[model samples]
Target: MPGQLQIAVLPSTNPRLGIVFALYPSTELSSPEVASMGMTLPSVPRTHELPPVPPDAPFIARERLLSLDVFRGLTVAGMLLVNNPGTWSHIFPPLEHAEWNGWTPTDLIFPFFLFIAGITTHLSLSSRRARGDSERAIRDQIIRRGALIFLFGFLVNGFPYFAWANVAGIPDPTFLQRVLDRLMHWRIMGVLQRIGIAYMVAALLTRKTTLRQQVVILASLLFGYWIVMTALPVPGEGTIGALLLDRAPRTMEAWVDRVVLDWTRFGMGNHIWVGGVTWDPEGILSTIPAIATAMLGNLAGRWIGQRRPLTERLSGLFAGGALAMMIGLMWNWVFPINKSLWTSSYVVFTAGLACISLATIMWIVDFQKVRGWTRPAVIYGVNPIVAFVGSGVMARCIYSIIKVPYDGKRVAIQSAIYQAGYASWLSPRLASLAFALSFVLLWYVILSLLHKRGIILKV
Candidate 1:
């Protein structure tokens, strides 16, 4: 393959010369001319040159902006912070999701991740198309990546599969009871699970769909969800939840959640979701509406990539985002902005926020040329999947699987740190947050090394 393709390059002294030697683009030298006693042969493009995009960023194409990577890196950072509390016993209200009917900063995390994923899908597919990749190849690639992500989520959620903590078939509880307790405690739906489903369906649906078609589909999903939720009677509560839900279409998505993705545990305030373990926040039914959030992101990415002025692109995102946010608020009177079920109003509202956030990033990084804080984020962004998976697995193994007996107690290394430094001296919340931040820094350092070495692990 290297021999067949023409590789583009430039002469530069880069630190990662070893990788460049192996993976550099292949370029054919022009027919060689005889050298004279005092003359040297013409210099061919150097094999060590990078793509034309700045060395500081990674995008679908080298010349494209790096806002998407920034978005993704920030998101991964947020996920690590939220997931890795020093102690579960002490958490700030902001770090926790709202009690089913309100919004919080933490609620924005999932939507932000999904929204970025959508934008990335658009940029990547478009770049591939520009390079004349066949539609079939793109489809297959999407399917494979989507499946792998979903499986990864499932594996993470099912870590240890059987509880090693329950070794020796302890008789304090029946063996069956032990396993059942684990299942009961297991959180079935989570961040990556949602990403998997959303990417698979959204990518297939949007892969070949026209912009007009996408708008139509998006509008129809929002409104159609509205109608079903308000009109249809919930199974257990009848129309109480539907009517009390206050939002027309938002209830539709929740109703779907209650009907299909039941199997939830007791939620906040001891209030059960009322469908007998059905209606998870990250359940199957609400995911339908989640796709629209990704669509909103795709639309922004498409607009940004157009050859329009940078100001025009940013303004368009702000304008569209404002409109969506207003519409969401207007609809919220009938359908509350609930994150657990991902109501249509919530979807619109969050997507608007996502759009505004992304536009601001583009305005500063790409437009104003401010790049002071971009290097760390850009490093995290280069190999997003690797960073996320590696960080998650490493954190889990250290915190849970590895145990050290200290002070006559069997404690994980993470717990030992908290016990000694946090519970003993500092406030739990601060300690927990510190641990989370430390986790992020650890991953960031690893990613920095990868970035410096030009090790982009794209799968």
Candidate 2:
């Protein structure tokens, strides 16, 4: 707060006297107050002589970085595009996740989101602390926000609240049975759920710690995960974790998911990922590295928030990102850059890329003053939760919840529409890509309207 305040002096109308102006941040000084005092706010391009205001004015808010929002928007848009293909089987190579032990462009979307969340979490906490918010209040807020996001993700996983018995060629069941089925099969881990967990853990870890302390904790997490994942032998697998890296069922992360989430033994097991049933991409053990990923972003946020020149900050990002990438590549020989596992090497590599990507955006949008092409991404970025949750619900409705008459019997509305509108006119891969793009464009329009109305769906 002290660093943000600036003071200036100018000659008054009398010319013999000089008036001192204390430029409280625009957040602390309202426009009307600035006008009444005959001063220009920081955001305004004009200058004026003004009476000095008290330096201890209460903190109100801080300016957000446009580059951050644009980055987040692009990530959210990419998530929508990747998640809503016309047909999952027809996706391009870059759009689909790697089958195992490697990554693609699609894999980066989730980690980028987590990284952005870490940066925003830092900014938000700093603003609150500046406002004299108590530690108790901040912790409660973190817990509450993280819980709500997790619950929302859970609901999204079981959206429409109905069983697809009829769609799956089974006889329709009673409403009670449908409800029970949904609860039984509801996924326990997902993108937003992992995000909520990572956000909460990373925030609390960084809350009362110094930079050196945080870096130590971060290194411990990465190394601890590596030690357990590679050095330790997985229980019952009769082999070391390194030997089981290629087998999803045998990996320590997947084994934990099966044990803790298995409803048969633990009463929560039925909630495992529907994709694999036995393992999940966002499973429990893997979340450790995910937390490290968020912490990495938090560290980057601290660096960005320093009172340093823009060029210096940009240079640091480039150099640090390069260093991290090199480290990740070296470690990948042992751990492998596996997104599903959220491996340590994967965390370092992806976070490095995140840093460099963000720095590039900052240079283009923040330093270079280029503004015209940023509008669409900004709209999606500002209302990320809206785009994510809304698109998710809409996707579920079309893909599974609704049915339409097809060539012989009924089919999911999504399939019906895709076959008739897109696949009918283009190659399978092209149709899939086109459908995904349409989904992105549709959300852009929706988010654009929300932006115009000054609506941002925050969690």
Best by lDDT: 2
The positional error of residue 261 in candidate 1, measured at the CA in angstroms, is 6.4
lDDT of 2 by residue, 295-334 (tens): 9988887777665777788899899889998999999998
Candidate 1 structure quality by residue, lDDT tens digits, 1-459: 212222233222553221111100111121110000000111224673333432222132333455655666677677777778887778888887777786888889889878877776676566556545689977877776676667667667656655546634464776666566555545555657778778777878889999999999989877776666656775556564457564423454545654444444343111113232434567666777888888777777677666667787789999998998898888788877888767899999999988888888878876787767876766555456676667777878778888988789898988998788767877778878777788888888887676556454333
What do the candidate models score in CA lDDT, each in turn? 0.64, 0.74
Q: Which sections of candidate 1 miss by over 4 Å? A: 1-63, 167-188, 244-278
Error of 2 at 276 (Å): 0.9
User: Model 2: what TM-score?
Assistant: 0.86
* Model 1 lDDT-worst window of ten: 32-41
Q: Give the RMSD in angstroms, all C-alphas superposed, for model 1.
A: 9.2
